[model samples]
Target: MSLQYFAGAACRALTARKDGPSLYEVCDPILRQPGSGGDPHLSKFYRTALGNPALRTLLRRAGLPELNDPARLNALRQALVLARDNPTPDWESVGGPIAELVDGITLQHPAPPRRTGAVAMPPAAEIDRVIRACGADLLGSYGRNGFIPTYAAFNLIGDPDIRGREVLMALQGLDARGYKNSTLMFNLARVFIARSPAAAVINPPWRGIAEPMWEPVQIRHRSAYYDAFFTEALLSYLETGLASSEQTGTARAAIAAMVDFCLETSREEVRGADGKSYHVVTALAPPPHPRFSRFFTQIKQDLGFGVYVPDCDTTACSFSAATQAGSNDPILDQPLVDFYAGYQVRAGGNEPRVTVPINDNIDYEGGVATWIDSMAGERPYGNDLDPTLNLDVLEVSFRNLTRWQILETEARLAFIRRIVGFQQRLVLSGAFADPRAHIYYLPELYCAYFGRCYHAFMALPPAARQAIDPGGAFELIRLRVLAYVEDELVGREMNPFDAALALIALGHLGGNEASFAPAVHCIVTAFGEGGRRHPYRAYEWNKMKTPTRILVGGPEVTSAFVLMGLALARRCR
Candidate 1:
């Protein structure tokens, strides 16, 4: 559709909001449209209009302010100029006053009565059904060599901690399955490792075979791009699982070997114009693997092998290096360095903090493209980058590391604040439009952040917790939960996974039982026939055509998230 079509759709969506328009309502239409699909000139023109400070204020204040009327737009612009020049323009005092229209829109739902203890647990049969459904998905999707098809398998295994003999038996059945790639195998191993250490020692189903296959000798020759971090993480888990000294020794040797191999293949020494030598990990090596670049920076950071040193003022240093590197592509260099430096700062101090400047050079509408270019780096699928998704994953990773004492307290809180800041900008800039009014991806993001926040508050020292505003974070989460309830529960967006995640966050926030009961019931009822499978996508409300299909995590991802929600609920109780 043309820009007008998109703009008109946004306006309709915004004004239709009973609780006043959210920033997402205005941005959703534009975001959903493919970047190259719309009229280039018209898209740019509308972006300029939205970028105008006066027009933006009007749009935010009065929904989409009669964008088609040039006279009204001009009048707003003139008034803004007068206000600037006259310091305090007495427009309110003048007889020719602009009417202030307030909708009195409020999106808040009454808080449910805070549970003194855990809410009632789901029936034993119900829990059993969920466990079975998840197990079936896991077993059904198992590829040869014990690998599952999607990253969701990691979530399934990682999040719930995969207890129960029945689920273990289901996993045991995949022992003979073969992996076509290291990614799948490493993930599969990770799942097994996350199980009880006793289970590994007593029932060693895939361990004997998988351990031999992952021998340092076998993996040493593999490309660093494909195997380094995955191999290291896999071995780390293997060391934890195998109780025997010999087996654990093997795992440790393999880890060291893989680390050395990565350094040899991925590291490059270069002399800058300042005649100083620096070692940095190349994004990829010769004979590139397809998935190489996507994980390059992450793997290097995970393995502790990057030019930027941890715990130093790496932010300034990395940014300086990017400038000195003299790369023709500043757009790519700048964001990549920022991400790298941010992580380094996070890794260095007990309280790691780095600031990522929201580019003012690109207006709100164009920020999406700029964010993609900067953040995605050399990845070919730059346009497909989802800021919410990236931030969610990053926040979770930071939280997990901090919990393990691998990351300092400051690092975890700093990273979380940065992510929250990014989300706040999207809301303020009016770039987070979702016609469904849930911001579509926001519940998931809020769940991730709030979940982390909850755990951090409980686990960190009081002083550390005080450094971050737990109440403010909860307020943001509570508002999003209300939106989720309105759109997904009371309304019909109906994504059980997202709902389940939101439920978990709400429980953590001490949400009143009444407010979240309907959501819990909705999720419980979503259990398909026999509870053997759940639909991969939520059915849209009123047959509304979603801009994109709901992301599929199959049964494994769905059941895992549901189980996690249940687990969280039980904990809260």
Candidate 2:
């Protein structure tokens, strides 16, 4: 009758299924600790007595063979016999040891070997206990801070924008010398496919003029978060070909330069119909400028971290917008008003910083456009684009809230649209259909986009919005999830080889004809193992040694996203 009991009962009812017990069953044992319960009858059993000297003597006197060795099967039998009687208080020493021994033996002894045919599924109760324990252990490990081994190097670089400049500079120099940041180079290849602009500039990383001053720059490290969104986006791009736009002169040249860079970087050279590789040696060396102590002093004063050689603190882009909200609004948005008022005026002189988190090497140009559009009316930096519009006196309020779910969703959708636009255009054209390209790009694209989408999707009501090509999304995304496992087990970039996983997620996870399409033929052909060949062993071979040897402190908080993706696929199916 109690509320607590009622809630528990209700949860069980909601989750129950004919297949077996719910995840809750496996989760409970891990949540509760041993020896926390009061009732002995309800407690877990343990063996202790057969090994106890006093108990063994008592058992011997009671005509039971004294088996002192803990591992011996005969020793355990003697202990169990004495415990069954639950002997009197004068027999305390004997009874105690006997009870303990019985419990110990029960736990230590292995169960009979299972038959081969469709091995019985574990009991719901037992399964729940083990799963919960593993989950708890995983959670604990995940919380440990992971070291940004490469982050220190970036911090040594100076500011976010400076770091970006440095990377671009490094790429140019390295290419001239025939070298490159393998990670950066790898990502750029995908970008070339995803956003085929006429000309694109890899801007210096942009550092936001704000507090907490975290870096918003995209990273290539594959974590749960990156796997969810970036993987999928990349996969989609590969399958669909590349995005094309109106600009084709300088813009096209710039993109062509990137494509050339990618081809040069890959082992198998990628060339157009002419069979000519584009090559350019535009390079810029670092200036022999004096150390800007001012940059360090101000950043430390405002953000609290001393700027190392490479500054890792950078914002991907800035957001500025104006909107109206609230009843007595003066045309400007109210939510933005309340948010700024509380954070800026009431708390201190601080305003909420808007940031875009990317984990891929983004074209500085594309990011600029995205940043501008997303924040067109949000009033990000106090500068009013339209003086006629006043944020403080707005009638309709603009809510400036940073929700993980929203960001995740937005990123995923944007990635999807970008992929669809690019892929559809190419397919309609007469370009050669390349399955290798499809498998390589699709998973990475989805991994990145899905994380962002799921981050938002989970917070919304169940019916709020459906996934892209619902069935396809699920199967494709699931394949992306499997790629996470594969990557973790390996240590090299193997995009094209692992793309089948993405297709599987879309087809299986979506679970309906709504997601079914002849286009699936495209997916199957692209990633099917025997069909399209790719470099895979390099990374997979590394997985075995990477975790133990790497300086990484631990897994990151974002890894849960990957687990969430897998769970969604499993449960959705």
The best candidate by TM-score is: 1
Candidate 2: where are CA atoms >4 Å away? Answer: 1-134, 142-170, 173-420, 423-562
lDDT top scorer: 1
| Candidate 1 lDDT tens digits, 341-374 | 2222222332212111212221222111111111
After TM-score superposition, the amount by which residue 354's alpha carbon in candidate 1 deviates from its true location, in angstroms, is 18
Model 2 TM-score on a 0 to 1 scale: 0.24
Worst 10 residues of 2 by lDDT: 310-319
Local accuracy of candidate 2 as per-residue lDDT tens digits, 80-169 = 233223321122332233333222211111111211222222233432232232233333332332211111011111111112333333
Give all candidates' CA lDDT scores.
0.33, 0.23
lDDT, candidate 2, equals: 0.23
lDDT (C-alpha) at residue 473 in model 1: 49
